[model samples]
Target: MANLYAGIEGGGTHSILVLLNQSGEIVYKGEGPGLNKWLIGLEECVSRIGKMIRRAIDGIHMKSGIPLKSVGLALAGSEHEKSKRELKELMMDKFDWIESVESCTDAQCALSMISKSGAGMLLISGTGSCCQIINPDGVSRQCGGWGNILGDEGSAYWISFKAIKTILNHEDGLETSLHDISYIKEAIHKYFEVEDNTGFMEIFYAKSDARKVAGFCVEVAKGATKVKDGLCLHLFCEAGRYLAKHITAQLSSIDEKILSAPEGLQIVCVGSVFKSWELLQKGFMQVLQEYKSKKNLKNISLLRLNQSVAVGAAFHGARSVDQILPLEYSKNATVFSQIEL
Candidate 1:
């Protein structure tokens, strides 16, 4: 039987599992719910992930007639040391083809894929936002990534909050450009089951966390796009700009030597915020253009990965078994076909 490699990518919304062969061809793929231990109960999350892993292995055996030998997982909630230990334990209890199990936070995998040299910056804005910078000397510094509450400035929730605030201001006669699409208003009202501003306020009054309130952004963005609200458009742009600004601040924190260092610096952007919001993407580029021109630094280049973090996770997993896996494995790997599920 041919040897098989296993890779798993876990995110807030979903999980992807892939099986690849020595030839860098994917033999199987499996998917399941998001595996963030915080979002989903840890026990439930691990159970779901285990099921997906089992399915992936079985699929690979069925398709390629190979026995699985190694598995690597890139987990969404694996940032904390405690969480990583727990995730590793959860995986250890599962299927036996796993000779060695390797795991890493999803962000690291994303950064690795963007910068094969491991020296670059990646801004990931999905349900949350974070900026990662890797210097030529292999020194790394992180900025933002405060999650939905203290940070996540350029996230969908942030934009949605702005849009809602603008709508409310218009209604209160505080602004003139107040635009409304019944679709959005209605959806928000239905989702919250609130009749008017008064009711919405009641819900706001009930829940104090900004993250909880920001949950309304994606649905609203989808609804408002149909109605063509100028205000909604502005909100997207603002969110994007906000994300870019955060990146700028992070970049500024880097040592001047790191900035001007001969080694190449790579910036990677991940997360849903960048992927889902058009405004955020535009704003990020605008901010980058301005920052680069102002700094006169030519060593940094931003990379936008076409593949989702899951692909990176899978690659991370594959590399764990053999850290020396040629860099081309990721580029030529058959993982993409298995990822679609």
Candidate 2:
């Protein structure tokens, strides 16, 4: 029997809690719906997470006869110190017996999953967009997480907003940067099940919620790509280029004095926005490839975490206690064959 550890990766779409043994094999796993505390309320969100934890604990102890000794939670909406403290306190209150508890932004946990020694950068483009860079020394810098109001430039939300505005502009016979949404006008109308522009406006304005509205990107992508709308394709490309710009700019922002990077700098990408759409991923990588070529930084590699981010979270949880398991464990695909996503 091996010591047990647990970890969680939480996001707006879903949450995964995984328990692992000393050999880095997943022993127990539980999944639940996602709730962004800011969008919902704190109590409801924490309660949902608590249910997931309890679910995993019940399963882990039942089969293994050993409780999780340590736990690491990589949660979304934990970008700030205050939120992290609040969530940590809540976890501690419920699972007081778990030793060496740690909490960090889900993005941080995603990075820990792909990079050994926590080197390289992580760019997430889902309901929102943000980038986290961690050098070998553990110091990190974050960019673009201003939320829907101020930033999140390359996010799905931004794309959805822009698409709606462009459609509206086209409907009103006004000039739009997209030139003409005329090609996909019928498709967009049918997709949203709206008869006309008035219905479109009413429905969009009524939804009001950021996540629900951002989901419009799915239709936007489908409509634009089906007809090969130049403007929509350009938007996706522009998004990729903008994300590339952030990546390059971070190189200059890192403090060289305190940080160290390993050979072949890795760019680990996580998020449904990039993952769900082939055109968008192509657009992003095409621009990123161009950027790499221009800068002659061929050491850069872009890799997506195909497995669940929960795998990363669980890896970090076990890593905290074991310390000897190579950080590169997750990088090797073979290591996770026994654990299904």
The most accurate candidate by lDDT is 2
Q: Which regions in candidate 2 have their CA more than 4 angstroms from the true location?
A: 1-3, 58-67, 95-100, 177-179, 191-207, 255-263, 276-278, 281-296, 318-341
Give the C-alpha miss distance for residue 110 in model 1, angstroms: 2.3
**Backbone clashes per model, in order?**
17, 0
- Quote each prediction's TM-score: 0.75, 0.80
Report RMSD (Å) for each prediction in the order shown.
Answer: 6.2, 5.3
Misplaced by over 4 Å in model 1 are 61-67, 94-97, 165-184, 190-227, 253-265, 275-278, 285-294, 298-302, 329-341
